[model samples]
Target: MLNILRYLKKHVGMAVLILALLCVQAYCDLTLPKYTSDIVDVGIQQSGVERVTPNQMRDTTLEALTLFLSNEDEALLRRAYAIEDGTARLTVSDSATLDRLDQALSMPMVALYQMGQQGMEPSVLIQQSEQVGVDRETFKTQLRTQIETMADQYGAAADTMTSQMAILFVRQEYQALGVDLDALQQTYLLTTGGKMLALTLLMVAAAITAGMLASRVAASVGMELRSQVFRKVVSFGSAEIDRFSTASLITRSTNDIQQIQMVVVMLLRLVLYAPIIGIGGIVRVATTRTGMGWIIGVAVGVLLALIVVLMTVAMPKFKKMQTLIDRVNLVSREILTGLNVIRAFSREEYEEKRFDKANRDLMGTQLFTNRTMSMMMPAMMLIMNGISVLIVWAGAHGVDLGTMQVGDMIAFITYTMQIVMAFLMISVVSIMLPRAGVSAKRIQEVLDTPVSIHDPAPDKNRDESKGDWRGEVCFEDVSFRYPDAQADVLEHISFTARPGETTAIIGSTGSGKSTLLNLIPRFFDVSYGRITIDGVDIRDLSLHKLHNLLGYVPQKGVLFSGTIESNLKFGGADITDAAMTQAAAIAQADDFIQAKPEGYQSPIAQGGSNVSGGQKQRLSIARAIAKQPKVYLFDDSFSALDYKTDAALRRALSQQVKDAAVIIVAQRISTILHAQQIVVLDEGKVAGIGTHEELMASCPTYQEIARSQLSDAELGGAGA
Candidate 1:
């Protein structure tokens, strides 16, 4: 989580501001509950000094506005008539009347007594004069009715506000405050209830503002971290990629970042609020000076228990959910990639069964996690109610002893409730932390992986290779192995292919031809000895320099989801129209490409699934030819083409790439029989290296392979 936070400076300030807002709001919300407790304790229980016929007060305020407006309108009409007769007075008594009316109507309904002051504001008398030019009864009658209606409405407002504050109103002890205190309490209940409720709402608005701000901050920071992780993953080479695949990386970047974001924002709102409630409850308790230690103790105990339960039950479930996500992704990928195979085998039911098992497993894990987290809410409520009951019992005894005032006892009970609620909030944190922890761990794994390919030293000389890699290849005692494999896939081997020569590798199966060829591009570093191009050790030169000097068409004929032109131009960005036409002609692929509905602009599905294997292979060969590389390695690239096309392609490529060296790895001996050199392999060892005539005369392995494939006619043709 802290690691994720390190990237927050770019966009974290907004999140921080939001958190601050939510915290401020939450504090206000906390204060309202406490304030209502004060209102009930001091005004409702102890005194009636707090007084209002709320509707009458409202009506008075409205009537004040109505009277002022009526007088002003009449004064305006009189001024219009006077102006017409050129008898208007600039300093009329109407001004004085309007001033007096404005003062009365605009007096704000705020708590003067709570501000440590008391009583009504100074009175303002509005003087109705002849200049006003309005009927006095008309103003008085309208203002009176408006005042009456406002009074009725204010009463309902005050009544409803007080009732809603019931949760914060401490259980009463009316007898203890005596008559004056009791009257004051009654007056407060009637007049100040709405004021307290409104204050509570102000606090709530602040809290909501804080929650929204904090969530946005979390989201913003999460987004930055997601980008950071993705950039790192993108730069990682094949080795690092193998450790965390495409699906897992995607999950970590999105879901894990979201998890962390939520936790941070939630922490800002809820954590900040908890402390205010907790501290306020404590202060209220200590000020009341009552001994309700048992109630507090029980509340704390319940909180700790809930926390423990959440950690024990929900923690593992959180971890389990992340694992289930990986399984679900794997199933989805399988269904997509193997759609054809599944259909061919008529196993849609089998795939569905596989998916169902994975889906159910994920559901079960997530369901368990949700259930455990949810248990905290109800458990919290139960504990809170129990604390409330205990407080009433304890406060009642304190009330009887005269050691606690009725008002004080009420306030203490309010504080006791706050403590329970605060503790319940702490319990909610327990639920959130577990899931976030699991997600954090998952994210950390990707960040920690070391990129497999290390950059070479800057000081390494460029002249280490010979002749712009003019394809003078040599393998001197070369060996190679996979990362996880126990044994080498290729043993000691030695061979060379000079410029304009064709070197072909042949084996029955499981031969290291492709693996050996892959090393030339420095795709995998050699395990033993050295491989050279034009007498240059392949690794000494930069990977870019080495790869650009050669063209490789792999056995699979890789193509992206784009048009044929785009895939062909992938090898050389600067390829021209003439070059594309020439390369396609050389590979014998121009006819098919031209025949397509959109010709070279025709869309190819991912992996060239839209084209036949032969067409895809031809396009791949064409792409390599477009590069005009000094050397070309064809790893069984012609396997998909018919014998006639393959023969034609080989002949055309030989003439076009006459000056460039070519290495061919083939399963069919006929494909490479005319090569300058043919290397035969059995298992991981090189069996023979010679020309076709020399291999047929001297190498038993080569002769046996040749005899098995030939018939009387073909054998006789070769002899002739």
Candidate 2:
């Protein structure tokens, strides 16, 4: 989660904007419940009653009492509202003054209480009205007459009072003036409904805007991650690539990045929005003063417990799921690449089962995590519905005692649902987050692995105008071994190949032919001794200078997907068409390339799948030739060509590449028999180094290799 946050910090400003929009959406959604409660409680249920505030009650009572009371009585009545320690006291000198002030203050209180109990039966009404010692019937009848007189004097302004005096005054005005209460209720409902509809629309717009921003930010994050991961993978040398296989790297760059992208979208849209709704729902419910608040807490606790349990069970599976995906990709890639062999060997069913095993492993882990998450919705629903039932059950008693209104009870249920729904949203996103976090850690692993190969200090790097280093390569007691190998693959090897010379290394199988050639280009640094160009150690050269001086062709020729022209120009973008043609001609690829309708413009499939092995090898050699480097290292490049094409290509290379040091690794002894220098290797040790005739006379390893591939006449001519 912290790693995910670090990536999000790159776009903090946009994330803040998304949060602001989501908050606006949540506010608009939460506001609707309050308006809904108002529509029910005030607009419809209390349409005929006046809701007078304390200020209105005080002002109206003062107006009515001014004509009858003295200044002292007025002061005493005003002090009745200013209660000390919860008791309202009027400072009156005599019974007359005290009675007058009491009458003035009691009028509004009695009117307000009577107005509130209007819908009750007579028995209930008598008990609920103010506790003055008057007969119920006479009190009610006189109360109505006094309220009408007050209304006639005060006019319509009497309806604004919160006290019972103002309520009775408003009731008297409505009855006498013949106003329709039902019509008033309808008008208020329509106004409240219109406001609710407006808010809902605004909420919808904000939600749409938030979704768009989330998608944009998530996609940008995915793109950025892919770019960085790809660049990092490209910079990795053999050691790093070996640490993480090709299939796993592909999964990390593609599948893992997609996982993080989806989670980012959910993080912005659902995860972030959940807290605002959850906390805001809590605040809204609290302000409504609903007595059933504990139900929401209970539901959240149940949800949290379920989430914790499911995560504990499913977290391990999520981590293993990615490795299974890598296995599937690895198996699938192997089957596809080896399809012909699999078919030839009649192992179709076996291969099918092999693939199915990998597929089933992935399926099993996915099923576990998905099935665990699936339980959440049904469980949350049970909690939600159960909470709803509890709220209604508890709230019904409040309604019976008139402690809570029907509308307030309904709003409480809605807010409770919102709170639980918020938790539900978070739980759903949380399930995905753990998986994405696993993927993020995997991606971070790739980005964090250091490259094995690095350049020397700037001062120690190679210079262009230094000695005759242009085409000279020297191996001084060089030895190398794989990372975990028990012994060296190449041991105590020393040799030098100078300009205008073809120094061919001839060895039988497993003699470290390719490994020895790879050292000159710094593909793998030597384990024992140093290799040099001219008189300077190869490690002292910057990678750019080192690679720029050598043209290396691997044992297996690989091509990218593009036109032939693009493939040739890949080594150097500045290679001219004439240079490309000359390189192709020297590699003997010009004939085949020109045979195609488009020649150099012909399209090649990935890995040169469109071309034959020999054509691919020729194009690979042509690509290296186009670079025109000072040294050429060919690792079994001629193994794919026929003897005739091989002879012609080597002849052309010998004449055209006179100034470059050429090192060839070949299994065929006939190919290197005419070279100026021949180094024979036997089991990673240098058996002999001399011309072909001298080696055949003195070295048994070279004689054995030469006698196996050549006729007596051919060996004799080579010895001449």
Candidate 3:
């Protein structure tokens, strides 16, 4: 996982931004519970008030208010209500308006008139109540109602005296109607609900922002990973390509990279969020004195145990799943490429069974991991619900004993659920971790592989500018063995193909014909001795310099998906139209290409599947011809053409490539019958090297090959 994160190092700022935004989201979520608790306990139960009301000092209510009123509470009232000399006073009456006393409501109303001058906050009266002589509960109920009455009449623009007088009379009027208490509770609900709604909207906005940023980062990482892997894969030589097969490399670059990308998004969205909610929930729930903290602890313990068990069972399978996927792709590619041969041989059922076996193996591993992961959510939910029930049961006693409020207990349950949910989210992401980690490791494997065929060291690199390559290719006792083979595929063999000449290699099947041609281009280095071009060891020459002087067409005649002209000009970026047409004419591809409706613009399907095998071979030859290299290597490139087309193409090529070295690996005796030099290989060694006539006379291996494909009269004519 850490290795995978190295790809994301460039986006550290974005990651930090996501973290900050997630913290904001978590704050909004965590804060909402407190508001809910406040609405229940403080908003509803306390009537959203902080001061005593005039109704509480009425003769009908004085007996109840005195019970919970402590000495400090009395002192606060005396200061806030202007109660002096054992009698509440009303100072708001004008100096000339003392006659209004008869209509001034009551003594409580008169005392409230001095609220502003007393400079007393309303909450102090309610908080300092330790000296109350009556039952605390009864006094608290009346005081809450009295405070609500004052809050009701405290209009936005009302002065202190007018608001106090209005509150006193309103309470008296409401008592007559018997509905003020319910109206106050409804107002508390509406105020608390509005604030909660706004906070909830803020949380949704923050969550959306975090999600978009995380998705962008994940997509960027995936793009970078695919690009990196592709660049590395393109540089790999035969040895590296064989070490990690084509199918596996495709899986790593596509499927494996995608897996890592998905996991990264999940980590950014959920992993970062879980910790804040988890720790914050712990702190919030811990402060509640309901004795239900143990339930959260137990739930977490069970969750961890479940995670351990599931991980233990699924981790190994996750590793195997990728390998199985590779196998399925490999088998499928082989079957698809060989569909014709399979049908010709009537092996459809056999191929089907082979594919089914691979598919079944992949299915089994996937099923195990998926089933294991699927079980997790349900079990986690069970634990969460069970903990909720347990908290409510255990906290019921605290609420009954007055040690905990019902609101506090409800909030504690919410916090506990958050804690459990945080862990649950972590566990869900954990399920993806093992599989994605396996994928990350696979992707890194390809990116980290050292190119087996790299450029020579600076000190050893040949200076191409000093001497021009005269297109002289020499094999000095070269031998090559496969990595694990006990014997060499090509033995100690020596030859030279000089400029202005044709050198043809004729060998029986498995006689190292294609292998010998591959060595010239450094597709695989010789195990012993050196192969040189223009008197310089090919290894000492930079790859770019060496390949620039040679044009090679592989035996299979591979072509990419593009226009006919695009395929011809593949490596020759500066090739002109005249040069392209001339090369096509020389390779005998001009006739067929001109016959197509689009001519050079005709599109070639992938692998040249749209063209006939012979046409593909001719186009492959033309592509090499278009490069105009100093040396041309045709590795059995003419096998698909008929005798007439092959003869015409060779004759045309000889006239155009007069000053270049031409090396041909051919199976037909007629193909190399008129070469300037012919080398006959028996097994891995050169049986004979000479003209066609000379080899037929001196080399028995050459004679047998010629006699098998040629009449005695034809052989005699060639030797004559």
In the range 1-720, model 3's lDDT, one tens digit per residue, is 886678789999999999999999999899899888878765665554312243223332332234334454434444433444433433343333332322223323333333423753223443444456755666565655665465455433223333334344435434543546567767768887898999899999999999999999999999999999998998888888999999999999989989999999999999999999999999888776566777888988999999999989989998899999999999999999999999999999999999999999999999988898899989988998899888888878766544566788879989988999899989988888878999999988998888878889999999554466679999999999977789999999899999989999989999998889998888888899999888889999888888988999888889999999999998768999988999999999999999999999999999999999999999999999999999999999999999999999989999988989999999998999889999888898999999988887788889889989999788876543
User: Can you write out model 2's per-residue Cα lDDT over 463-547, one digit (the tens) per residue?
Assistant: 5547556678899998899888899999999999998899999889999998899888777889999898877898988887888
Which model scores highest in TM-score?
2
**Worst ten in a row by lDDT for model 2:** 50-59
Could you tell me how far off, in angstroms, the CA of residue 423 lies in candidate 1 after the best superposition?
4.6
Candidates sorted on TM-score, descending: 2, 3, 1
| Residue 229 alpha-carbon offset, candidate 2, angstroms | 1.1
Off by over 4 Å in 3: 50-188, 717-720
Per-model root-mean-square deviation over C-alphas: 14.2, 8.2, 9.3
TM-score of 1: 0.71
Query: Could you tell which candidate, 1 or 3, scores higher by TM-score?
Result: 3
RMSD of candidate 2 to true structure, Å: 8.2
* Candidate 1 CA-lDDT value: 0.70
Instruction: Give each model a TM-score.
Output: 0.71, 0.85, 0.83
lDDT winner between 1 and 3, please give it.
3
TM accuracy, model 2: 0.85
User: Global CA lDDT of candidate 2, please?
Assistant: 0.81
Per-residue C-alpha lDDT of model 1 across residues 360-379, encoded as one tens digit per residue? 99999888887877787788
